[model samples]
Target chain A: MKNRIITISREFGSGGRTIGKKVAEKLGILCYDSELIEKVASESGFNANYIKDAGEYAPGGFLSSAFSHRSSGPNNADYLWTIQYKIITELAEKGPCVIVGRCADYILREKADCLRVFIHADLSFRAERIVKEYGEREESPEQRLKDKDKRRAAYHRFYTNMKWGHAQNYDVTLNSGTLGIDKCVDIIKELY
Target chain B: MKNRIITISREFGSGGRTIGKKVAEKLGILCYDSELIEKVASESGFNANYIKDAGEYAPGGFLSSAFSHRSSGPNNADYLWTIQYKIITELAEKGPCVIVGRCADYILREKADCLRVFIHADLSFRAERIVKEYGEREESPEQRLKDKDKRRAAYHRFYTNMKWGHAQNYDVTLNSGTLGIDKCVDIIKELY
Candidate 1:
C-alpha cells in the first residue's frame, strides 16, 4: 500500500485540507480535491454556476443533493458520478494520489492500494479549529464537535451506505489532539 | 482531585488488571480490585468463596457451587445488590481507588469526586490475551474474543444497569489498543 490512495475523511476545520496538502507536497504527488470538482464541471460542461452551487459547501448536504438530483431524470447522476469516478480512477491508476474527500475512496474501493483514514481530535481541538477558521464561535466547543460528528456520520452513511468512524470502517482512526497533525502524518507515513 | 475515584471497566483479558495495577502504583494509591471483592465477601458473609465467584463474574454463570445460605424467599435481588453496594460506597468514602471491573462508579454516583472510565481494545489484541491466559490457541481466536466481549458486556450491564463501553456512560473512554494502559492511566490521573 506504499503507492497508496489516501482518502482522509475529517471533521470540518480539522486541518484535513492542510494535512492533505502537506502529504501531497512531501510525496511529490498531486492531491486531487476541489480540482477534481473543477474537472468534473469542465468535463460535463454543466453550467459552472450550477456546479459551483451544487458542488460547493452544501447547506442542504450531500445526500439531499444526491437525492434531489437523483430524480432530475436521466444522465444527471450518471454524468456527475461518472466524472468523479473517472478522475479518481485515473488518479489511482496514475500510481498514487492523496484525495481529500468527496467519496473518492468509495469510488476507488476496487483499487487494492487504497487506505482510508479518519482523523479526529478532542472537542476542544475541533472547536479551536472552528474558532480559528471563523474567528467567531457560534456554538460551544462540545456542541460543535458532537453536531459535526453527527452530520458527518449521517452524511457518509447516506452517500456511501457505510458506517462512519467505526473501527472496521477505517484502516486507522487517530486522535490528532494527542500529538497534532504533524505526528499523525508521520505515523501514517511510517505505516505506509 | 488528586484523590478522586476512577472506575475502570474492562474487557476480559485485555490486560486491564495489569494496567490498573500500573495505574495505581504510578498514582501511589491502592487499587481496590480483588481486595474490594474480599471485603465484600467478609462483610456480606455470603461466604468469601461464593461472593468472590459471584461478585462481578456472570451472576448465574456458576452452575457448579450454589450459595450455602441462599438467602431468599423475599427481597433476594435486593439482598444481593445491597452487599455489592455497601463495599462500593465504603471504598469510595475511604479514599481514591482504581476500582476495576465492578460498577464502583455507578454505586458512588452521589459522590462528586468520581471519574468513570471504560477501557477497550480491538479483537486481535484481546484474542491474544485469551490465548496467553487460557493456553487455548487451537480454538478460533475470533470466536473467543467475541464470546469474551459479549459475556463481559452482558455481565456488566446486568449488574450496573447501564450499557458498558458506551462513551456517554463514562467520563473517559480510552482505546487501550492505541494507547497502552500505562499512558491511559496517566491521562486519567491528569484528568482527575
Candidate 2:
C-alpha cells in the first residue's frame, strides 16, 4: 500500500469522521477531517472561520458565473478549492491517509492507489444518529440532515461535476448507519 | 420492527449469503437464498434447473421484443419473476426474513420497513476469496467475478428498470471484502 490514499465522501450525520478516524488509527496513519480546515487556513493565510464557513455552503449561481468569466484568477471559492486540492494531493504524496469529506474523492480521482468511498444512511437512521449524538439543536435533526446533505451535494457537484452519492463515482460505498462506525472502520482498513 | 425484510444484493464471492444467513440466525428468522429457487420451482412447476439457469442469465433481446408484442401472457422470464415476486411478498407478509438477491429490493420497495443492502468488494479482494473458498475452477476467478456481476446487473436492470449496484437504489451498501464476512454479518444483524 505505497500510494494508498482513502478519500471519504459522506452524508451529514453518517458518522464518517468517526469511521475515518478509526480506520486511520487501525492503519497507523493520520486522518484529516476538521483538521483539514486548519491546514487550509494555515497554508493559504485565510481565517479558519472563513475557510470553515466557505466550505460549508455551496457557491451561489452569481458567484459561479462571476468565477467562470475569469478562469485565470481564482475567486473566493475557487481559491479555497485550489488550496484544498493542493493540500489533499500533497497529503497523498506524503503517504497513506484517510480523508473525510471536502470532496477528497473527486480531488484524487486520477491517483492510481486512491480508494474513494461514499458513506450514507437512510434518512430516518441518520436523523436518529444526529439526535443521539448532538442532542436537541435549534433545527430538527431531520431538517438539519437534509439541509447539510443538500449543501454537500451542491458543493460536490459544483466542483466535481459529478453526482455526490452515486456509487459509480466511488470505489466503495458504506452505510455507516447500518454497519456502525467500528464495522465501517474494519471494512475500510481491509479495503485500503 | 414490524414487517421487516432485508434484501441483500451482492457482488460475486462477497459472502452475501453468509451474511444473510448469520443475520437471519441472529434474528431467529428464516433466510431465503437457494431455498428461494426450490420454492419457485415447486410453485411454478418449472424445473429447478431451468429456474436456476434462467436466473443466472439475462433474457435475450428477441425474447424481450417478443414479450413486448403480446403483453397478455407472461413470458418465461416474466413468469419466473412473477412467481418469485409472489413468494417474496408472501414471505414478507408472514414475518421478518432476510432474502439474498433475486431483486428482492425492488420487489419490496413499497414496504415501509424493508432494508435494501448492496454488498460489493474490490476485484482483487473478491478474486482472493473465490480462490480460497472454491479452489481451482475452469474460469479464472477474476473473469468469473466479472461475468457474474454482469449477469446480475443485467438481470436486475431488465426486471427492475434500475441500475443494479447503485447506492441510491439501496438503503445501505457494504464492502464485505474489506470488512470480512463475520463483521459484515454483525453489521447486518444490528441493522435488522
DockQ, all models: 0.10, 0.25
Chain A only, candidate 2, TM-score = 0.89
Q: Which regions of candidate 2 fall more than 4 Å away from where they truly are?
A: A1-7, A12-35, A46-82, A89-99, A105-117, A121-192, B56-73, B131-139
lDDT of 2 by residue, B1-192 (tens): 459889999888888888899889988999999999999999999999999878856565322532455545556877788889899888888898899999888988886378788888878888998999889799999998988888888788878889888776775677776556777677667656
What is the C-alpha lDDT profile of model 1 across A59-125, one tens digit per residue? 2454455455544443454456557677778778877778886667677777746666666666777
Worst 10 residues of 2 chain B by lDDT: B61-70
Scored against the native two-chain complex, candidate 1 gets a DockQ of 0.10
Residue A97, candidate 1: Cα error in Å is 14
The TM-score of predicted model 2 comes to 0.68
Superposition TM-score, candidate 1 onto the true structure? 0.57
lDDT of 2 by residue, A75-156 (tens): 6877899899999888888888899988888888776377788888788888998898889899989899888887787788
Give the TM-score of chain B in candidate 1: 0.79
True contacts kept of 1: 0.00
Best by DockQ: 2
